[model samples]
Target chain A: MSSLLNIIVVGLLLGGIYGLVSMGLNLIFGVIRIVNFAQGELVMLGMYGAYVCYLFIGLDPYLSIFIVVPALFLFGVIMQRFILQPLQNEPMMQIFATFGLLLLLQNVVLAVTRGQGYTAPSKLSEFVISVGPLNISVVRLVALVAVTAAALFLSWFVKNTMAGKAIRAVTQDRRAARLMGINVELAFMLTFGAGAALAGLAGTLLAPIYTMSPQIGGNFIMAAFAVVVLGGLGSVWGAYIGGFIIGLIEAFAGYYLDPALKTAIWFLVFIGVLIVKPGGLFGIAGAEEVGLREQN
Target chain B: MSKTDTMSGVTSTRDEGGAVPPGITTFNTELLRIAGIAVALLAVTWVYSGDPFILNIMAQTFLFAAVSLSWNIIGGFGGQFSLGHGVFFAIGAYTTANLYINWQISPWLALIPAAILAALVAVAVSWPTFRLRGPFFSIATIALNEVAFVLANYFGSITGGPRGLTIPFKAGLENMIFTSRFHSVLLMLGFLVVCLIVCAWVFRSRLGYYLQALHLDEDAARATGIRVLQVKLVGMAISAALTGIGGALFAMYLRFIDPPTLLSLPDIGVKFALIALIGGVGTLYGPLAGALLIVPLESQLRAGLSASVPGANLIVLGAILILFALFMKKGIVGLVMQLWDRFGRKSQ
Candidate 1:
């Protein structure tokens, strides 16, 4: 019984990490309707960004978020404007381009770092809090809190803010949004930026917990894809809840089954969900089909 | 029926009619072209016969050209961007390796079962995934590759797990093992020729037209009474079968089998599509053109930069992918066609 509780806790925390990693990916998929394969690389860049801050300025990984998020936002905006926008009409080319970006970013980092692993030191990472038989690390707890807060914040921002509304309008119908005097391009750019910033946020938060490697992004990207697909595409709450569901599944599977097979198990669930509900749990029905069609 | 008529057909017809109809080349003409290409490749192989380094590169080029051509049957022509082809490739490699090692069966015979099993698996997996469109399909395929990777590692008895399987050296004609690099290159050349013939046959067939139509618009194809799922399944099966044979050839050439070597996305899965894209996604000769360009360049880059800076070759490759995606969507064949239309037609 105690072990079960521990597993649940572990799953929830893992889910929190997965949720944070996937938020930006879901946002980009939701708004721009382009699958950013390099979003994981963006997060990887953020983790490295935080590391640079810690290395030079001696800032904590938590505090470095201030510097990293906006930088990533700007980087995202640049990538959207230059790389993705030109190939907007061609989905096949988009996949090639982004995958190219993934390899470029991953290998460039490898070249620069020479494949040396680094751990970002944070005071908060060292703390642990125990409740009865359940012991939780503070960094993971912080990630869980951060994900919940970000979800609430994103939901409110999309609902209330003009920029958020514009993004939503663009997502719903780009032509209608264009006719209604909304700058669809600008909205896409900003949304991509926000999505990238969120990835950066995830990176900064996660840096202290895991040993940083150039290939670590590959680890998060697959799990995040599973989370996004399972929860629902473009649905904020769905991503939040979906993260926990995947997390719980991974945790239970890891404990019950072979730990190495957890990824395979979740992948099976992802494929199962994709076949059964292509739109995802929270996505609008038929959106999956509609999203791929030419919008302009 | 004249050579000049076929060469200058597009422009000559354009002058007669306002809009040019697509030049329909017969199977005999395609066969002649294939023969021409084969002779040229053989000439190059003969020139480099004594040089082990060049022969090794040539062997790899032919092997990948065959695999990429197979990918083009479904991916380029049929318009299904599958990134999980590594699974089928791995299946072929493992099957051939296991049959040769465990049962002492010849790889030549094992090739039959490998191709059949690969086709079966391709049909089974693609049936469900075919429902997805564009990026969704690509994503699902990537997931599939990951799943296969895990399963391969898990099933230690079958795949030999993470440590991988290595075949002992026993050179013979029946074993599909060669004592000389020249023999291996010739074997790979045979594989490439088989793939080229299959692609050419598919390219001019009714199924090919149906695939092209569906690739343009699935709903419209369905409306026009095309069996969308069946056509895609057939194309995928053919593609997977050929890829399986390529895998068997690759296993025999390298005399080694492992999950990463066989199934790595960067190396095997994506490389096939990348080669197709670089040469001409849907063109018959594109994969060959692409493999010719990429394989040697990659080998050179690996030789030069791998010692100084790890992953420099991939950086260059990644940049090239992005640049090509932006500037050259139609690839080398498309560019050559365009240039021919602009210059060769005018000169005539």
Candidate 2:
């Protein structure tokens, strides 16, 4: 029973981080309809940002979130304006561009880091909180709390903000959105920025748990994709729920099976979900055809 | 053009084998041209026979070309845009390497079973993914590749796991290992020839027509009674089998296999796609063109740059890929063809 409880607690905490990372992918895919292959790279970059702040400036990683998130947001906007905008019409080429970004950033980071791993330093990094036979790491609890707050804040932002309404309008139909006098390109840039910021936040949140490396994004990128796919295409809430589901599955599988096979287990579920319902568990029906419908 | 007319046009074009598309010339001339290129390739190999480095590059060029050409079937001709072809490549390598290691079987015999299994796996993957279109399909293939990567590590006992598998070096005709670099390269060239032959054969067949049709538009292909699913499955099978064969050859050459080296993401998977993309997609010899340029450049970069600058080559490659995708969407073959059209032979 204790082990089960431990798994659930661990899974939920891990799920928070997963949700935080995957939300950006969801937002980008929802509005821009481009899978930011470099989102994982962005997360890696954010972790490095935190690493730098701690090592060079002596700022705690959690505290550095203020700087990293906005910095990443600006970087996202620049990427969208310069790189992604021209390739917007060519969906396939956008894949290549994002992949190019991924390669470029990952290699750049590798060169800078010299293929080494570093744990972002923080005083609270190892803090643990005990509650009646269940002891949870305080850092993980913080990650969970922060992400939940972010999700709620994002929901409210999308629901209330004029820019958020404009973004949603563009997602439904780009032509209509443009006709309605919304700055479609600006909306795309904003969405991309938001996605990047969310991914950056995920990086900082996960920094304590995972050792930082150039290859850190590689593991998350695929799992995040799986989460987005399993949760539903273009649904942030679905991604949040899907993240927990995968986290639980991974946790249980890691304990029950050989730890190495946990990713394999959830990916199987991802494949099954794709085969059974390509729309994802939380996605609207017929979302698969939307991408196809765009070109013609 | 009507769908039926397009189908028949592709069919008639195939039957003649002389109908030069936009990039090709007249039938007899094109055949002569191909023969000439083949002779030139052989001459280059023969001239540079003493240079072991050049010889090794040639061997790799042939092997990688074969793999990329196989990928072109599904990615270019069929428009699936798979980024996980390394799974099939790894499947082939593992099957051949394991058979040789565990049972002392010759790699020649092992290639057949490896390709067959890879084909079956391809069919399985295609069935589910064909339902999703565009980047979704590509994403699924990536996910599937990860699943295989993990499993390959998990079942490490049989697979030699992450520790990697090294084939014992022995020189013999049956073992397919040769003392002279020339013979090894020749073997790889022979495989390349087989891939080219199969590729050319399909280029003129019903399968080729259906594949091109599918590439243009899946729903339209289905409307035209092309049996979209069947064509995709068949295309994937052929591509996977050929890729598997290439993997077997690559394993024999390297004499070493590891989970990371075979199909671990960008290393092998993206390498094949990049080759095809750089050369030209949906063209018969594009993979060869890509492999010819990229494989040598990769080696030369390592020889020249990596000691001083670690990530320069990849940064250049990424930049080039982005530039290619944006400006030169059709790739190097298309550029060459456009140049040929402008200056090479105006009166053809």
Tell me the interface RMSD of every candidate, in Å. 0.8, 1.3
- The digit string of per-residue lDDT tens for model 2 on A185-219 reads 89999999999998899888777778998978987
Q: In model 2, what is the error at residue B7, expressed in angstroms?
A: 32
Candidate 2 residue-wise lDDT at B314:
78
Candidate 2, position B278, lDDT: 82
DockQ of each candidate, alpha-carbon based: 0.87, 0.68
Once superposed on the true structure, which residue ranges of model 1 sit more than 4 Å away at CA?
B1-23
lDDT of 2: 0.82
lDDT for residue B104 in candidate 2, whole number 0-100: 86
The regions of model 2 sitting more than 4 angstroms off are: B1-33, B345-348
